[model samples]
Target: MSRTIDERIVEMRFDNRQFEQNVQTSLSTLDKLKRGLDLDNAAKSLDGLGDAAKRCDMSVLGKSVETVQAKFSAFQVVAMTTLSNITNSAVNTGKRLVSALTIDPIKTGFQEYETQIGAVQTILANTQHEGTNLQQVNRALDELNTYADKTIYNFTEMTRNIGTFTAAGVNLRTSVDSIKGIANLAAISGSTSQQASTAMYQLSQALAAGKVSLMDWNSVVNAGMGGKVFQDALVRTSELLGTGAQNAINMYGSFRESLTRGEWLTTEVLTETLKQFAGAYSEADLIQQGFSEAQARDIAQMAKTAEDAATKVKTFTQLWDTLKESAQSGWTTTWEILVGDFEEAKEVLTEVSDAIGGVISETSQARNELLSGGLSSGWKQLLDQGIADEGGFIESIQEVARESGDAFDKLVADSESFSDALKQGLTDGVVSSETLTQAVHNLREKMTGMSQEERKAAGYTAEMIEQIEALDKGLQNGSVSMEEFTEKILRPSGRENLIQAVWNAAKGLVSVITPIKDAFREIFPPATADQLYSLTE
Candidate 1:
């Protein structure tokens, strides 16, 4: 059965081919098993080669082992590559899951949260650059989320209030710090956002109108008077002065100081007093000038009596012209008489006659009557009254003029009644001798005083006293209201007594009716008692 050399060579080549094919098959099975992570199946497939070897010729065994060893080395390379690819894919999926839960919601919920997202991105980048662990990044993200939620809530809540502030010329969103400050102010004041907005707006308007300066505004707001009460006081002061923002500010200061001092002056009274003082000072200056004494006196009187500055200036000018003309005529007449010129005297007399007619036409009845006929009538009255003529007739007239000016100055400075009377008389178009006399009489009466007991005896009641006291308090506090006084003080005191009487009557009625009720109840069941009560109703 032994073959020849050529046949043996051919058969050996066939055996080598078969061994290569089996090794290729085994490598393919290992590839599949490695993909499935079935290392045990791959080992068992390699072990199965022993059974295949028993069937093969013993001569080819060395070649078969060499071929199988080469394929197994190839299989190890494929297994490592597959495991690496799987690990990379799992890491990518984990990252996508984290982004879907956290980052996606922030992007969708708030467009303004872009800045917060950028902040978080920077944090993550820094953490990665520093080689931080996942736990550190997670902690940082949690803190950022908390801060972002709070910031968004605050911004949404104060949106309307911020709009109001912006309209009033304040920019709340200029910085994160400023926005936080506004939130704190709202919280500390215990004010609703709308109320804070309204208060700030009103304060801004007051400043713009020059009703109060910035410093005063700050003081008033800090002092807790930032609402309607503060606004009303500023408005009232502006209305009264009618000019000069500074003047209003000064008046407000005085008004508040007066309240602190317990001085109760109505706005009307305070305004009138200030006007009178200003007018009096102006008139005093005119007298010091070389104006004719009578003209100066009339100027002072008009200035004190007129309601407005324009009216005061106009009325004074009119009276001054009349007095100046009469004074010039008197001087001309005196000079002519002194010169002993008969012809000049006649000319001067004619001029004086014309001035008298002009004076009569220009003045009210009382002043006209004083100047009737000529300067002679005025001189005759002065002589008849025994007024000393230490100088001469001309000097006597000058003296009389000086005395009239002095009288007006004294009336403004010393007598409040004279100032009030003069104002009333001028307004009524009754500025005559009788009005002046009455003003003097009024001044005298004001100087006299009455005790409280005397006032009460004269018919001032307890209720009237209470009302007066309440009004005084209200004026001092800048809350001038009769209704407030009646409700807060008068009614409360009086109602207490009335309530007590009513309560006593109710108790007495309960006692009187109790026995009759008991007698009915003794004869009747509870149902009968209910029926009896229903009958009464």
Candidate 2:
């Protein structure tokens, strides 16, 4: 490649250029190799970082699982405690509900009240069916119960006696009256009412068949005493010695048989038989025969005549005859029984007044007004126009009072008067501002006249007295009507409000629980929600 001087320089330059090019090529190759080695080291570092990232991810996953398990355990504890509390509360509430519903005294009272209501309804319906009025039926029943209680006989026994009389073609009213008459005779005769009733029934049958007459035995069994003869004879026989209780009962059977056979025996025959038989028996024997020791001694004395024997024993017949005579002397009809029995009439008056007064004093303005105004007016009219010929002054007053009382009872028992709509209207009228103010003023005046001791004795508490005074003050000051004042005082409060609040809350809780309960019901067995809801109510 070298030449002569110039050629040599050119060749040398070429050679240098060639050598420099070679050097540059070699340096480029070394730089390329260094770049390859750096790439490999970077790749190895990236592989190590990926492995570390995988380990960190596994550690985080394990920690998350452990936290979930710990939280689940805590939730289980809280859930179990809450569920246990709910179950215990439900069980206790259920027990209390059952106890309160089943065994409370109020439950018994409600049951008795329902029974009485049903009985009243039945009686009403029965009265309608029997073509009888409720007042008459009720009066008859009342008389039956009253006499039965007085005579120590069950009312059913008297009713059965009535049935027997009615079965023998006697009308219902007559049967009832006859049974009552028999009961009265039984009380005097010291015999069971049933015995007297049975005897009377047999006599009724005999009279119907013409086996007996109303004008038999010295007119003892007159028209007034028609069906009552057997009972009267039994009563007289029971008072005779040697024919005391047991023999008198036996003698009644014989008399009844004699009537059945169309044989009418005189009341003297009963007396003569007792005297002849008693003449042989000692006082002890007569006592054993059911005569009292005094009666036995009198019978042992042996009176000369049946009249003398009759004078020894007190004759209820005279009293019965006096009652009959009173009936003839202007005290006719069923009212005749009440003649000469002022104490009995007074008792009846007291009972009737108390019952009617209680009914009249209830909240209905119609009833109260009728009691205070109409009834008073009617009574006044009756008293003013007293019947002069009817018995005497007392009898006339009794008759008028009875008529007024009966009219009042009919008014009170009228269904229209006691209707709910009418009652509401009456209540509204009575509770009006003007009426209540007047009522309060009147009540206050009456109360003001009484001493504190009188107020307390009348069952007014200290708080009630204070409230009354406050109400009066409010009325006088025009701050309130007495009605409004009373309404404010009596408005639901304290225990009542608390009870209402609790009930409302319970109802709200039930409403909220209903949806959840229904949802659960779809998944589980159905529960008695209605029963539970009723308990809640």
Candidate 3:
């Protein structure tokens, strides 16, 4: 409807004041949000409390943020409609003002012009959604985007402000940067351009350093090496080696089937090797088989020693086993010995068998000494006598030597099946479950002690915030901004008002409950998590 001069003046003044107040209110909400977020979290003492709040959690804060976004979008639509009307009004008013030329009509029209400017600014900055201009009739959508940006920024500067402003991320690049994901996560935005840039840089640095984002690594087996001992073990066991004693050791270990390699074997090597091999057979098995690694390097060496022994006891054992089997069967020993394809081996076995009586005497003596608690002295005596026998007792002595040598051959042969094979299996396991499990346990332990707020903040790095601040400043200075101050209100700082509202809501909840908790912590001084959560009826 056409209005009188008085009516239009009143309308223009009222709308201008209201717009200014809305700007102030938006700034106030942002300020309160910052204050609430920064509140000291020391009073929060719940174990596993940190899990209560997550940056990615789309709960109360997130839902509220979405509501704000929807509202802002609606506000954009409303502004567009208003701008279309103002543009039409501006044309006719300009003509009428020019025609009247009287101070009254000119003054009324000037106020109208100012109101149109404000309307135009809102439409230009915020008149977009789904490829449709909210101000459907308005022709200056681009200009409206620019104007909205400048207006919001000017308002931001006027009431609420983040650290020095700047342009970041894509202001230097063409096309509007997409932040739909961010909007979905946060209900309100207080992140300045510089803060967003700082976040980007932090994210970049984390990537460059080969860190998986928190989201990416949240489910990782070892939290990307954050576990204490597990982390150290991985580094120690998996890191590439350079030339040094450590490197040499690692190489030797690897060659010897250890996680790390070593250049040379030592006494420790021999002991560990022996212990590991001993694991495969019971001591009873060793006694029955008469195997020992003490006398030979290989099965061949042990076999040779057994054959050369004075009494030939060990070789005779193989013969007795053969004889016992042959005797127990319906076979004739002579016939088998003469006609069997294994005859040469059987003939040699008979010769060793002839010496068993002599070897048994020496063997009995060694056993007697050991049973009598003189094992060391007896063993030393046996070694001292060696392979030499000066008397006619050489037959018996030789038998003992051959028995000892056979024991050594069997022990050496088992090494392949036991020690070397076992060690090799462990070294080849590419990732250790034991280490990863320990890391997960440790990370959970460390994080569980913090409050929910702290944990939420933990995922957010201040470095990212600094980068965002720098970006905001860049935008302000037009260093990297495609006129961000005029076009980028759907940015980190766009929903400051909404962010503040959420914070205030959280704070208000805190204010109501703060006194009791503070009093309780003071009086009881909770010594345990259970005590902190204790409530009264």
The best candidate in terms of TM-score: 2
* Clashes per candidate, residues 3 or more apart or on different chains: 0, 0, 58
Ranking by TM-score: 2, 1, 3
**RMSD to true structure for each model, in Å:** 40.0, 35.2, 54.0
- In the range 345-456, model 1's lDDT, one tens digit per residue, is 4466678888997787767756744543233222233222222221232332223334445443343345464334333333443343333223223322322234667655
- Give the winner by TM-score: 1 or 2: 2
Best of the candidates, lDDT:
2
In terms of lDDT, which candidate is stronger, 1 or 3? 1
Q: What's each prediction's TM-score?
A: 0.15, 0.20, 0.10
Model 3, residue 533: C-alpha shift (Å): 95
> How well does candidate 3 score on lDDT at residue 99?
51
- lDDT per residue as tens, model 2, 1-537: 333688877789899999999999999998999897897788889999898887675777788999998999899999999999999999998886555434442443333223323333444444445676546654665555444433344454455455444445554455555555444434433454346555555554643453333333213332223234334434344455322434433655644443444333332323222233224356787678676787666555532222232222345643433332222222222332542122354567788889998777675766655544332322222222212111232232223334324442333345453222222323444223343345444454555567889876766556554555566577679875444333432344344566789999999999999999889888986558897898899
User: Which stretches of candidate 1 lie above 4 Å from their native place?
Assistant: 1-154, 157-183, 200-250, 253-537
Off by over 4 Å in 3: 1-133, 136-432, 460-537
Give candidate 3's root-mean-square deviation (CA, Å). 54.0
Worst 10-residue lDDT window for candidate 1 reads 171-180
By summed lDDT, the worst window of 10 consecutive residues in model 3 runs over 157-166
The residue pairs found clashing in candidate 1 are none
* Candidate 2 lDDT (Cα, 0 to 1): 0.48
Winner by lDDT between candidate 3 and candidate 2: 2
